[model samples]
Target chain A: MSTDSDAVTAAVLVIGDEILSGRTKDKNIGTIADYLTAIGIDLREVRIVPDVAEAIVEAVNQLRARHTYLFTTGGIGPTHDDITADCVAEAFGVGIDVDPRARAMLLERHKPEDLNAARLRMARIPDGAALIPNPISKAPGFHIGNVFVMAGVPAIMQAMLDQIGPGLARGAAMLSETIEARGLPEGTYAGRLGEIAGRHPGVSVGSYPSMTQTGFQNRIVVRSKDAAALGAARAEIEALVAELSA
Target chain B: MSTDSDAVTAAVLVIGDEILSGRTKDKNIGTIADYLTAIGIDLREVRIVPDVAEAIVEAVNQLRARHTYLFTTGGIGPTHDDITADCVAEAFGVGIDVDPRARAMLLERHKPEDLNAARLRMARIPDGAALIPNPISKAPGFHIGNVFVMAGVPAIMQAMLDQIGPGLARGAAMLSETIEARGLPEGTYAGRLGEIAGRHPGVSVGSYPSMTQTGFQNRIVVRSKDAAALGAARAEIEALVAELSA
Candidate 1:
């Protein structure tokens, strides 16, 4: 009994030692999450592993097994530490080679003379994988099985996602509404909010307490696939916040 | 042989349906990363998973196996959907109960009558877990094996981290130094920086490019355990930035 729904589910695996060391603040996770949601694909999980092969392999295998699609960033660059492609290949029980199609794409931008050993490393792809077009650079990311490997750079990753996201399977669109409460401590409204949230089984409510230069602010978010349910929950939340403020 | 060097390594698992749906932007990942780094623990891997039992269980098991410590934020609140504590118990193959230690801490702030069935949900802990003191609210986070379950609220999570950080084992402190380049594109200095990085095997060099209202800026970070190597690398990086700017 397949629902044949458009809902697409995916997970992201970020590969880099630099992220772990706190040397780099990852920007791709948020961007991808936003983009995937816009395309109606739920980004279910994100994992950041070092450039180590075993970690990458384990994450790749586990995420791939769980999600309908998997998107991996980093470790596909030309540097020596870029081992994600190899690890992904190993995880999928496939072989990797400098694919003629990938090499052709690389050769389109860089001259054969400029394509040094380091640059050539970017052309390697797992066997039986299709290329994910990269608009920023000629060197393309590739898709093997259900896994799509893309660059770590935000711009490049965005471009690759633009090329591949449209073709992926997607589910029902998730909807969200936010209600703002001024100068409210979370403790003041947490109980009533919990009651309202519990009453609405389909809606998921989150309380975010933000600090401004002036004072503390709480933003409550109610999200659900059912628009009417979301509206009802939002109304309750607004009423509760008004009562608390009064 | 205990190296006497405190070696603290942590992996962060972010649990929330909002993150997966892209309804909420994650502020907790960066905050926890910065906190762990400042407290002298190597913040290794970060995984963001949906509020699903199987997904949470898989991530908890994998990360707990790999890291010396594990910190999970989100899904530990009083809501029915906040299933992190239960999922964690299943992952560890242990029973969960309203732990006395955690309930005692909660009792200090919450009135005995006010500790309703919903409020009591936060006190659930895995078998044989120790409470991690929470300064903001007396309801403490509990540690079962290496996994320390914490709240998703940035302020509350920070408070719990402050309490538990000192007791954890830490590795040799990771040190970093920065050299700033004015109005430099990464490509301009990429080759030279790669050469310098090659020269110093111990130092991990990363070039971060930022755009300001004025112009572009590139910050080169040199990180290593060895003080002498780091100093040398910093000098070379400064000189390189100067040369590039000139």
Candidate 2:
């Protein structure tokens, strides 16, 4: 992995019909987003597409071209709908077949006689890709170019993510501080918050308003890659909250 | 709001930096997905983009052009980051300003004196749009063309969806049945499942594998608009499972 220090940005492409059909609520997007942020990689965008090969191929190509890295989860199992690997290969204009390395990983869990044609489907990897080992399940994920493909199951995806995490180049980690507005609603402090955000170009300020059982709860979040800028913005937001509360 | 019987589809655009930063776990995408499915509007795709004007505008244009309807959540608030409405207007190349109807709705919740500039921002609506009433906070969402814009907060978004749902022209509602594989792993039944899926072009079959306390739990879900096709696929899947188990 090249040690580039630029702002590392990533996009997540969740491939599944289950998620779009609401059969499965996606836990992977949040997990991946949190993981990328913690690793100093900014998660810029996310797209959820159905199991259609055309949709999958188009999304992979579009996202991979724009972001520093594109991570995909789901549609990699041993069923008819599991067509992500082929779609990714098509997206990159590469040939795909059962890789010996991936087949070896499957051997750790399945006996040679038990590895049927369907089971061997799990061993298909795009040409020139590196395997991302799955500790929970023997079926490995793979990364080609700047895209990482992993399992849809949260547990297996987590394991694969851990394996892929170390090799990624680090960027300046974004620092953030949240200041709760307590009882003060966003309408009470939004004007001033906007002004504060405008003044701090180095930092991004966001006021989130959510409804609690009692009433509206609001929070002001300040984020910046620069530590001093983050601190300054957080201080201003805290003071704004204090003034609004008083 | 034509009562057309053709299959209706939608795409959701979630706009917020909080979600991208992982500061907030997104609840809107799943909620919208389930709602759309229940009403016979197939949720085709979902995109989560940050609070950037260019990104929001581009996504809005792309999604609205492709799907039968486009639903957007978040960024329609009273802060600097709340730029969704403006971005949407820019996407459609329409003029936008505070609408009288939206302002009237806001008046139900906010007093004239309390309707500050930031609060007034909630009343901004694009040209030639119909208002979606918000009962909770009374800051109405709106629809211009095929795109419906709603709040980021779950409660407010749900209310707006309820208002929008009754007017939508629904297609045939998809019917689904899930068959449990008991202790049978996907690898055991994947081959037959693939054959069954291939035989039934009218229905979609998906095999999902999850780990439980006992071990792996797998389920085969068959969905189709035609009940006859759904039943045919389900029966074949059931027979395959029994044969494998015996």
Candidate 3:
């Protein structure tokens, strides 16, 4: 029995050395997070793994085992380093081959003459895996068990997510209420804030210290599924902020 | 026997449920990556685990064992959820207590009377660990073996990194040269780029596709420890991009 009302859960495994090297700013994670949150499927975890086969296999097995759905971005290219599909297949103990369905998708873009060995690498799919259509590129993403393997490119990954997001089971929307502190150090507010947070067990209150041109500002965020409880906590927080400022 | 000159390496383990729940946007990873890169340390891998004792212990042990330095952000706070110091102590098989050094640091800001049970939580450190000075809240970070436990808050974590960055072992700076392609699809340049990358065995080239207001652009980045090799590879890449555009 599911304890959570909005129980659809997912984890993202971002596979690439480019990101680890910091040469690439990861836009995919933020994009996926926003998309999943909007669709009501809670994104539980995100892991950035290198191009290593062993790492990919281990992360795939672990995340897939834990979450209801797993979305993997990157390492599905035609290059030699693109080994995500093969590793994912190996993780599930399945044989990988150039699937006709995947080939058909790619065939639309390239002439049969132009489809070389490297290009054909994109068409490889694990057994019993279903294809998730990529609108931008003809090469489709494949799903085996709970894991959906998509391209590393942000645009294409987003496109694939847009296609798949609608089909997944989603949980209740996690609500948030934010109270902006004008000019206060987080330390000054920490004590009373902790007391309020402790008193309200259902709501989670987080103090974010941000630097402004004026000075330091703390943004207190109250999050809960219950709106009434959230409102009550927010009022207390706002009152405390006022009291502290005075 | 380090292969490359100026080779700096770090592995980051982010401990928090806030990140997993997508409640908090992780600012520490990018900040640490940028800081470490600037200091000549290549951040090789990053892991985000929840505040679970088993997970924290396992990640800390594994990362510290493999990497030159392991920087952990999060799970060091006043809340009940904050358990990184204890877990880290357990991982190292060391006894933990409210260490004098850490308490001294915190006592500077907090009055002896103001130091409650919750506040005292920040002073706990494993035996044999060195204090990592925190410039923000004065709650000191600790270093156990090669693992540096830091705060989850971006600014505080950044402050700790600033204090610690200069002291760490640094590798040769990972230099990068960017070659921008206007309106070039990554697929169009993918093959030749791969060829160029293969030719320059020491250099790593990544193709980043970005969408502009006008259209799409692909930014090719060539990174290498050897500046001369990077320049040579970059020239070849520029020539290829010019040829492709023509």
Candidate 4:
């Protein structure tokens, strides 16, 4: 049934042992999250699996099946540990080889003599997939079914996203408004906030308390796909905060 | 059944709409990841779910069953949106209310008169749980089975983690050593590195390439619970990099 809401959804699968080992702090999850939200896609889940084939395969299959789209980053490099392309193939029951399109992309950067076996690893792509160009690097990412695989490298991954973002289906943009409560404890106004949220059921209102150097400051963020509804809820929240102050 | 193998594993459930909407970049997931890894607990899957009760309940149930332990951050606050404790109880099929032990901890920071209905919401805990001391603020976290629920606030979450880390079961420490390869492209050394990784088998060695202003610099990181195995792998990696230079 066609409804007012745009329902394009996505999940991010970050494949890396570095993240799980605490050697790397994930910057890609938030990057992808912000990008998806901006493009009117609901990013429902973000999962980080290790470099292990089973872990990668299982996550790729699970996330792709549940969401409208799945985006994976990392493990598509030249290293042996970079096995995301192979894993994607196994997950979808497809064959994988050095894709000519991907190879051509790599050849743009490296001379024929320089394209060693290790370097050529970046050219492998799963069958029946379209290449997502990486302008900065010669390596290319690919998309098969609803899943798009990109590099773990942030710069390369971002370039790939820029290439693909314009082509994806988008829904109505989700809008958000924030109301600040200066020096107000959430506990002081939580009950009323709940009531306000219930009254404006369409908008999802959240209360976040940050313990600043001065004291606990509260910020209520109201979000919805409908801008008018979000504004109405924000107004109610502002009124509630003002009343609590008095 | 429990040998020298480091078996302690953990998953983090970030409960908030702020994160999913990309309003707040999750700082707790990485914080917990570092903490768990440092203490010999392998932090596996990390999940970010909205403040929706069903999402929280499902994540808590699923992650706890899969990992050796599950740590959930956020929603254990004073607001109506703060339903982690309630959802946790529902997940475990137990009744929840304002726990006396948790109330006593809150009383340490708040005067009885100031303990308003909203403020007291922080005292709600599942039927049976050991209170996790929160030194930063008086709101105590709780341990119900393998799940530890804490505040979403980074500072307070860190405090709660510190309180509980020592009490939990720890396995052999997962140690790592890093060796840098100056200006070495992964393509030049990926195949050999893969061979070295295969030979070691015990320690996990990963080759990461970072693009700096100078050129592409690679770092090989070797990790294992066994110190001797890790050292040996590190030596092999160092030798390989030296040979590549030659």
Candidate 5:
């Protein structure tokens, strides 16, 4: 049964051949993930697709349809490979052109004489979309329906996310407590942890194992939207971990 | 039209609620991406989903069906939320049980008495699957069909990747040249870059703009399996950038 009516969820679609080709390591996904979680928006899924129009379009359509908000980064630059805007327009079945509003935003950064055709490509926004202002580059990102098209550059994307952050509908904030089971291997307490998790359906328990110089430094993270359930599970888990350690 | 008959592509399925929840920043995706690119296997698509079984199974099925190979990281540890093994089995419609091979591998690190039920979970492999050895920790990751399941831990995952790297079918290695146009803005050189890309059908050109402390530090990357095309495009891009710099 659903506990909250205001369970806003989001998905991120990272569109770039640079990322897939490993020329660029993506920082936006994690940045957005952390931001959304802080704002009580559940980031359900993330998909990274190449600059190819078909891939971008398919991913955008699917993600936007499924989640309350779909944030996309990359491919809005003024290059041949930067086709995210066009792909998004095609996905939404809308006409796209140079919006005067976006051009005005660009005017702040570029002189009127310097606005070449390639520069003008950044002004192209789908029909009926609201512009998400870029404070850094003045090349505006846009929000059409549930989808937000942002710049690939981390700074610009962060700026756009900050602009849109205030307006998003939020869900119940997920509260989590992490217990370090550094010397305690997951196998030692996993069965009991599972049993505890089953008993408290509202809580989610995860065991993460990281390698240290000595051996495995494991951690158990308990999360729930309900503070009472979260606290109870945390207490039980902490006790279990303590018993195992002793 | 396909240029290389040996074009082996891969999709990465990162299974973790910790990643989506932003408690963990994913280092594995980028590591795998860089490795795949170096090995000539085009990292096509990547999807990061939560620990939910249905989501994991659906993503595994979809990614494995589409790409030449699907490499999954996370959810294979001995914990309550570690269900990637079962999900992969369900996705492939196969029976799963503790494989003797995997247990034997685990026996190298874990004592016979220490190999409890929770520890035995690591040994669970789908029928007809081959065990991918984990050199760091003896818990083995399995490769059933085209999907190679590995641990979420960076060190362990890297070891598993190293173990399996030599056997993967590789495509023609993509050669790339990066031309730094740090001072020149993207808008100034984007048109010429687009033109160069259009003329060279075999090459893939990308303009990446990153913000420096002073301003935008941009780079143009030209990539192709054909060395001649890659060279030509790189030369043209360099000329264009040089001319613009003047």
Candidate 6:
């Protein structure tokens, strides 16, 4: 759910057996999370379901009910297992057919003879859904209700996102500031850091550790929609890190 | 939920703000999915929650109840935001404290005088949980009930999993084979591919597309625990791809 009234929340439903079986490492979740955050939509949850219709339909219905928007990737291809469009239609209780507009979009890349039955599978759209144009691939994605069904391939999904970006209903952007705690391990400053977080309810604080060529690095981040409040929290965290480092 | 009685199911709870804000790309999910699949656990769902205690507690309780095993990554550090241990304790209605064994584990890396309050935070574990040793960092993960709380660092998490691997309850391994369908769009063979997949009740068939130097390359994968069934399905797909290529 969206945390604040001004926050637009979203959930990603990645549909593919390749992902569940670990044959494919999903790049879309991180990519879409970054994109949505830029436009003030909080990515609340991400679920990866196999290329099964019942699984896709169940996930779509459940996620769409809880979030402001649901974005699905994969399973919209021309393969037998590519059942996302049909499943989405069933979820919304709508009929689906090959849209002339989507077929026309495909024709931009493929010749009339090349638009065989297999290729035409990309043109099917759920009834009452608008097309999300794919610039890289002619196969268009679609937006029905709060669900946006996009291709699984990272390049095509990105292009579709760029196409639909301007039309999205964005909320207040969450501003974030990061402070590196240089060589200090998290344990050195963790106690007071929690107290500092407790003092600032407006901001969310987190500490992350990463391995680098030299050694480990810890970063503390403060995030909030309020710039002034975020600034105050950032300053406090910086001070805390300084005190501990000294 | 696990589809078959013989299948062991799991859910991943990724807790961190770095992932949600897209500051850090999570490598743990793919690593764990591949690991679990190899060991015969079906990862049914994945949820990424923030550092908030309520969010962690809610997700932990919900997922732990739904799946046979729950693996959590992130928030087990020496910082205040690293409250996963506490949240996990709350989820299970248990008391938590710094166990002597865990402190001893930390002492292997840190001098006794250096084990300050912050570093000691890593030692606090829920009641009745067994430590999952971390060889890289010496910060131990814990397994309690059906839940495993692990580090966010990929290296440490992997090491901990290696340490705890032998103790896990494993089902029959799910095996897979891939067939390359050269120079074909998924739609060209999708209809017949579905028919073949329907014929094989024991195996799952999936089509995946990738962009290469030439153009689009498609691969069909057949997966199942039964080797003979998987072999039969794989043979059928290879034949289909050859026919389509011809």
Q: Classify candidate 4 by CAPRI docking class.
A: medium
lDDT of 3 by residue, A157-199 (tens): 8889888877787777667778988676565667678888878
lDDT (Cα) of model 5: 0.90
| Model 1 spans > 4 angstroms off | A1-7, A179-202, A205-216, A228-246, B1-8, B38-40, B89-116, B125-128, B177-223, B227-246
lDDT of 5 by residue, B202-244 (tens): 9988888889899999998888999998898899988898899
Which is superior by TM-score, 4 or 6? 4
Model 4: lDDT of residue A21 = 74
Distance (Å) between predicted and true CA of A113, model 2? 0.8
Q: What does candidate 4 score on TM?
A: 0.96
Of the true interface contacts, the fraction found in model 2 is: 0.76
- Across residues A148-215, which tens digit of lDDT does each residue of candidate 1 receive? 99987777888898888778887766677889877765656777888888788888788765556675
lDDT of 2 by residue, B21-118 (tens): 88899998999889888878888899999999989999999999999999999998888889988998999999999999999888898889999999
Better of 1 and 4 by DockQ: 4
TM-score of chain B alone in model 4:
0.94
Best by DockQ: 5
Q: What is the lDDT of residue A80 in candidate 4?
A: 80
Of 4 and 5, the candidate ranking higher by DockQ? 5
Quote the lDDT for B141 in model 4: 88
At residue A70, give the lDDT of candidate 4. Answer: 95
Q: Worst ten-residue run, lDDT, model 4 chain B?
A: B1-10
Ranking by TM-score: 5, 2, 4, 6, 3, 1
Top-TM-score candidate index:
5
Model 5 bad stretches (over 4 Å):
A1-6, B1-6
Candidate 3 runs further than 4 Å off: A1-8, A38-40, A107-118, A179-205, A213-216, A220-246, B1-8, B111-113, B227-239
* Error of model 5, residue B115, in angstroms: 1.1
10 residues in a row with least lDDT, candidate 3 chain A: A1-10
Superposed Cα RMSD, model 5 = 1.5
Residue-by-residue lDDT tens digits, candidate 6, A86-126: 99999999999999999999999888987877677889899
